[model samples]
Target: MLKNKFFLIVAILLVFFVVYYTFFGGNTASVDGLEATINPATYGRQVVEKRTEKDQFLRTNAESPILDKASFRGLSYFAPDVSYRVVARLEPFADKTQKLVVSMSDGSEEVYEKFAHAVFSLHGEACRLLVVKLENTYSILFRDSTSGKETYGGGRYIELDPKQLTDNHAIIDFNTAYNPYCAYNPRYACPLPPTENKLPVAIKSGEKYIAHE
Candidate 1:
């Protein structure tokens, strides 16, 4: 009798596990091979190198900078903070076709499609951020309290891989946050970050403010 009861309990537990995995766990991408071996420090290093290369390119060929007259001391950035690198849950917007009217620096308006709402934690504070897409590319444009002070008043931007959007996991690394071209030169019309995307904390990572002449 005892043996029979033990077998019955095991079978019941197995069924419960299967149900949970099918509904919830199944939404996440299966971690296998190289992805399982990723190290945070290695990923951080790669991001820093990429940002440096971009700055080099912009300094040489970017028309937004008054390169002919302004003194370029190279771009500035806060040291990469690992705390700002977070894996967020991607919650698809109720209506993918929802549109947002984005304002541009040159007194113009543009439309952006709502992609999804990213639920994530930053500095121990839980928050939800809107994800926007233009054409087939997805990205996040946000403004933090650091803006107009430690960073660009127009806000900062980061690109998101479309593959990761519905994988249930989205990687948001503030270390890659960048200023729009308008931050350097008003000549280029750049989209202003929407008020709904503003954060209350100081995100002291990524690019720093460089006063343009």
Candidate 2:
């Protein structure tokens, strides 16, 4: 009788595991791979706070990219939308030693390694972007359909925190995208987005272009 009860308990546990995996594990693409829980409200609030701090820095900091501090108006931006935050599957390049030469706005060129490809979906469209190792973190230099019309003409950049990335996935938050320093001052040599990194969709989130005085 005891042996039969043990087998019955094991079968019940197996059924529970299957049901849980079917409902929850299938959603791995939506949540941060390292973090199981995602709070949209809190994430939106953090994005706002960071943007506010950036505006303050641009307005007052001595090393700010804005050349005319006195007449400098705050930077423009799209409203924070949590939907722009996406979880991307990171696929490392087969040839890790490959180098990508990118042109700069100042006529110079910068070299970057072809680190990985970040694949994700946004606005019901499949997207893939080239990732590169920039200093200690990873960065994506990209131009979207909004370029030259709604955002900066040259391009915009998004830097991923190395700590936030897992082996196979990372968070690609378009809400944190920003124009390069060259957009504000031509004195700075900023790297332009490569042809492969140009996205076909209109990314309506992140910073917008404001005519500087």
Q: Which candidate is the best by TM-score?
A: 2
**Which parts of model 2 are misplaced by more than 4 Å?**
1-32
Q: Write the per-residue lDDT of candidate 1 for residues 40-77, one digit (tens) a residue.
A: 56556887798778766766765546444435656788
Q: What is the TM-score of each candidate against the true structure?
A: 0.77, 0.82
Off by over 4 Å in 1: 1-40, 62-66
Q: What clash pairs does model 2 have? A: none
- The residue pairs found clashing in candidate 1 are none
- Candidate 2 lDDT tens digits, 1-213: 999999999999999999876665544544444553356666678889999899889999988989888987688999988888888899998887988898998899999888899999988999999999856768999999999999998999999977669778988889999999888887899999988888879999999998674
Of candidate 1, the 10-residue stretch with the lowest lDDT total is 29-38
lDDT for model 2 comes to: 0.86
| Number of the top lDDT candidate | 2
Model 2, position 190, has a per-residue lDDT of 95
